[model samples]
Target: MGVVIPLEENKNKHASVKPLVDLTKPGMERVNQLILSKAGSDVQMIPEVANHLISSGGKRLRPMLTLASAALFDYQGDADVKLATSVEFMHTATLLHDDVVDESDLRRGKSTARMIWGNQASVLVGDFLLGQAFRMMVDVGSLEALDVLSTAATVIAEGEVLQLSVAKNMETTEDDYLQVIRAKTAALFAAAAEVGPIVAKADKAGRNALKSYGMNLGLAFQLVDDALDYGGKSADLGKNTGDDFREGKITLPVILSYRRGTPAERAFWREAIEGGKSDDAQLEKAMGLITKYSGLSDTIARAVHYGEMARDALAPLPESDWKAALMEVIDFCIERAN
Candidate 1:
């Protein structure tokens, strides 16, 4: 939950995401309480760690997506709250594991779970959270819920493996990159959005609309994430600006830069990605090439493309404020810092 990007940086880097709250609504307050209650508990050590991360304060995007999707279908069940929490729990579990895997030191401006707790504890507690998410789904009592979560979990694992396998490989293609995004980042988002309608037993068209919305929004979010990693405040991004280079992770901007660069620039990228150590000088040179190629702009366009697709995906749903809120969330994905 890295949270130290200065307000100036966020404002300078881009515009703020439009606010979506309809403060007059009762469901919104209930949803917030539900999220808080679901994250509450008595397991001192694990829950403490969980609470530390949860309270570090993200925008609570996943749970919001779940609630919004349910609202689109006019669902009034208490199960939506539980399901939203379940989605957040699953998302948090992935973040814990990801921090350990990435050897990440900071998240949202706070120490990573792996940095605070031992690796073993982090892994085990993450597993515990994952199980709790599943238990919550079971309590929701929908087979569709089980199917969506199980599939999302499987894809997340696959994405992790895919990323690991291709790490530092200069030849990683755009299609391959999208595959990894779909697996790692988008899977849970898709599930979070789709499950609401599924639980409410919405018709096929509505379910598909929500699923498409989540999938596109997730892709857009990850694209922006990769772009920001190269050209963002380290405090805002939670990871170092050149971390992808340091860790040998080949993201879209880097790949595109490599493709568009001069012979020396291409060689530099090859060496950097393939076990070359980069100091500030080399990092600056690499960033210069990325800028020359307008890689950031290209990445933003891609993100915008997905954002539009996400918005278009909502066409089948009946018009409602919740659907509008979901659209705003997608806008936030492309525009948010930290």
Candidate 2:
């Protein structure tokens, strides 16, 4: 059976999401209603699987960015709500597909939809969500918004393929890993934030600022998640710790540890990571090596660097509560390490 990590325990740690959540409450309420309405279908199974994951515990950060970005420009129309819903559907679809590709048993401390309903169902429902997302995008009638989101979808698919190419390969470079996350994780963030300004008809500078903020924020977010897999509690991570190690998936910490370790240490990594010799004992040894080499700390440092970049991206934007809330988000992302 998969482990269940209760989210309530981490409430204090995740307060960064609170301000944005409160600020976007009205907009998000509309997005939530649309999400449920659009998720329904005659097929029954489609909504079953889609709602299973949708109702599961996720912060819905991407969609909030869309809502908040539009709110920044004081957008009064309902377009932002639809766009926010679209961003969420895109994110949910990606999660379903990702669990299948990773063969993961747990997500947000619950059995994955694939594990419960099977891979075929998960994939098909993910496709359904993607379709619904595009329909919403088209309904908004912004060619530029549609183009940005469609481009992000293409980039996300390419990023998934890129990750598969590098999986279990210890020699994956930092540059290669960065490229993968930039596309797979950050692309939607960029699009979600950029679409806000687009819908509000903001100038190019405003659009570009939000784009930069989302992209850098996403990089920081993923980097911290990678670090958490090695050092965090199951409750904090929403999955068992060392799942990455057991999966033989090479993340930044493993790459750093492998690159910096001694000859015998490198062999150990090769045996454990590439050779798939992961076990409880091997995981313990792996943790030792990671700690000895400061892999986790270094990864956090890199996250801090990107967090700073995200902060800088917002420097030119006029001050507002939404902007302050976004800035707090950057601090929250980096502070999750504590």
Candidate 2: tens digits of C-alpha lDDT, residues 284-313: 899888888888888888887887798899
- Per-residue lDDT value at 322 in model 1: 70
- Maximum-TM-score candidate: 2
Which 10 successive residues of model 1 have the least lDDT summed? Answer: 1-10
TM-score of 2: 0.95
Candidate 2 pairs with clashing backbones:
none
lDDT (Cα atoms) of all candidates against the true structure = 0.79, 0.89
**Model 2 alpha-carbon drift over 4 Å, by segment:** 1-15
Worst 10 residues of 2 by lDDT: 1-10
What global local distance difference test value does model 2 have? Answer: 0.89
- Candidate 1 displacement at residue 68 in angstroms: 0.4
